[model samples]
Target: MGNSFSELIKNFDKTRDYMRDFYIYGFKTRNDFQYKSLRTYDDERRRIESWLGDFIKFSNSKKGKQISISCDSSKIEENPLYNAYRCKSFTKNDIQLHFFLIDILEEDNFISLNDITDRILDEFEISFDPQTIRMKLNEYIKEGIIISRKQGRSLVYAKSPDSFQRLAGNDSDKITDMIKFFSESAPFGIIGNYILKSLDKLNNLFLIKHNFIVHTLEDNILLALCQAIEGKNYVSLVNYGKSHKKTEIKCIPMKIHVSTQTGRRYIIVYNKQWKRFSALRLDYIKSVDILEVCPEYDCYLEKYQKNAVYCWGTSFGAKRPKEGIEYIKMTLRIDEHNEKFIIDRLKREGRNGSVEKTGENTFCYYGEFFDVSELSPWIKTFTGRIIKLESNNKQVENRFYSDIRKMQKMYEVK
Candidate 1:
């Protein structure tokens, strides 16, 4: 329907425009999209329907009729809009000139601008001005696709050396195999996947347990933020929270954390205005554009490293005298003969903590961690085994008791 569908991998100007609008501001009525005329609106609507007809839905309400895409995010195996970044559009002139220059230029000979233009007209019957040809050649030179050399008073152009198989003959096979694995496993593996596909060596040998669907479409954004982090730069993020309200923030991105169980990702950023580390869900971030390198980026990194010692989960506690520092000690009367695995789990899950045998069958897991209240779910698993539970935070103790009381009342246990 659009130029993106015509090309395999490049820019799709029309597809980008239509998709960008729908993605950023979804659930909009016909009146919400203010076009110059009704015909223009209908044209765009038709184009959108053509691309995502299966996904799109219409609804009527007191707020007037609206159009939306009903997608079960958890069930989505592939993001449809991923093609927008892959397929790029090209002009007729670009196609003609690319072939013209390739045909005229030889590997050994260096041809001048005037000679190249004359040859293009004589050989291919296509007459492009010297200025247009010069511009295109200069662009190619910048891209390192072609080479230019100064011969006498004139400048000449030639093709660059072929470097397809850059690896040595001995290690080419090993390197190719590594690329195949990295293409599926790495964070920005799509680039490697593209290369592998071109070589026709594409195979899904590694079957990952948590194959995140959003990771494919979100790779472009992830790459930009990663680059910014490496450069010690700030990123202006247009993020949406649980409320679906969009807000913009200029933050110095520090760390990226991924939950192994959920396959969810979060980025920890230092908010300049708030003067604290704020964690934002990666999926909720609508857009991120890199800004100038921050002068205090290194300082922020050092501060984060120091502060990370207290962080239990993703949350960095609020500013206070001690900053919500607390420890939770969960002592259980575990019957090792019946459930030896419970003792093993305590030691395994307890990071930089101790699991001690207080009695023949009792074990005490004593750990000081920030946000111990977040560990309530894990504590509940040892309901029958829990002999004693203690925490420095009063709120945690109160909530633990409150939950036990609720369970007792519900089960009507004496």
Candidate 2:
């Protein structure tokens, strides 16, 4: 069991079992999907048990033990979990208790039993039996190595800072920093469960235990949005804006947009009654109730795909080009600094348009009119970086100049 060959064989078998289960039945939590294949269950259980045992044995080894880990309190404070806890429906008592527990343990350091127990009772006012307290401490200790020193009749227990340092030092900090930075800085609409899950799995593997309340909320919203997009049915949602509106809308969710520049997530949906495309912010949707029946729109998915390109918002109209495609040629004079950005944008909106580099610092963008108006603001954004060279529609040029004039007048006033 200690040898490399033995470990390799054991791990290989465990991996094979996991792969078989994943392929046969996918992953099923206790509350979800009930139709589990016997083969999948049998394999999954074996793999999980094997992994647990291996991890335990590994923790007992010399290489797995540590004394301290490096952690930045400032970084943790800015995590999405902290924000989620603030917004989520957690009781005040629960929040206080959870924070107290975390504070007593002090993430990267070790603490004695007497100190921990006393702090818990004094701060949380909970007096558990010594045996029960020990049991609880042991559970967390098992997840990581606990360094202990004999003091009087009691053993002072603390996480091995060395072990923590080892875990933290090995790419965990980089990953945590990456996730934390992106989650906080990313545009509001850009946050999604896929990124959250990715961060969580990475943190779990690296033993970088951090808060995940926001990630949980993100997952719930993503699941509901996905269900709606599949034409499952109408959903009852409460808007979180100033008005605090509540309504049940039968919507055909068409597309999800993640802005590269802003990093926000937006869902474009066809509001049945409005008979128009609507952009909904994922975070503002308080709750969603799935419907039993699907939508009755014909070619809704096709229409969404055809129009959701190079567009900022959902506004595909009836007068859209023939067979739902309209083309427009726009010329822009871009400087060297803005050339890369414009090229990237053109690539993303491929087939909807084409770009030709006319000069050292100029390009022409010709694209179909799925939602040309949406591009107006984006074109204006490059005022200092680019100039509109030519517009197929004279009205478009006039509108741009009109907007610029209005902006100039507004800025001109002291």
Query: In terms of TM-score, which candidate is strongest?
Result: 1
Residues 258-366, candidate 2, lDDT per residue (tens digit)?
5544434566777667766767766556566766555464576666665566453545644433444444556666665856876776667544567788887777777
The candidate that wins on lDDT is: 1
lDDT of 2 at 301: 68
TM-score of each: 0.70, 0.45
Query: Taking the tens digit of each residue's C-alpha lDDT, what string does model 1 give over 12-108?
Result: 3344445555654456766766754555556656655655667777778677776665555444433445434445557888889888888788777
Superposed Cα RMSD, model 1: 6.1
Which lDDT value does model 1 have at 255? 90
Give each prediction's root-mean-square deviation over alpha carbons: 6.1, 21.5
Please identify model 2 stretches exceeding 4 Å from their true place.
Answer: 1-77, 86-220, 227-233, 239-246, 262-264, 274-276, 293-299, 310-313, 318-328, 334-351, 358-362, 384-396, 410-414
Model 2 lDDT on a 0 to 1 scale: 0.52
C-alpha lDDT of candidate 1 relative to the true structure: 0.74
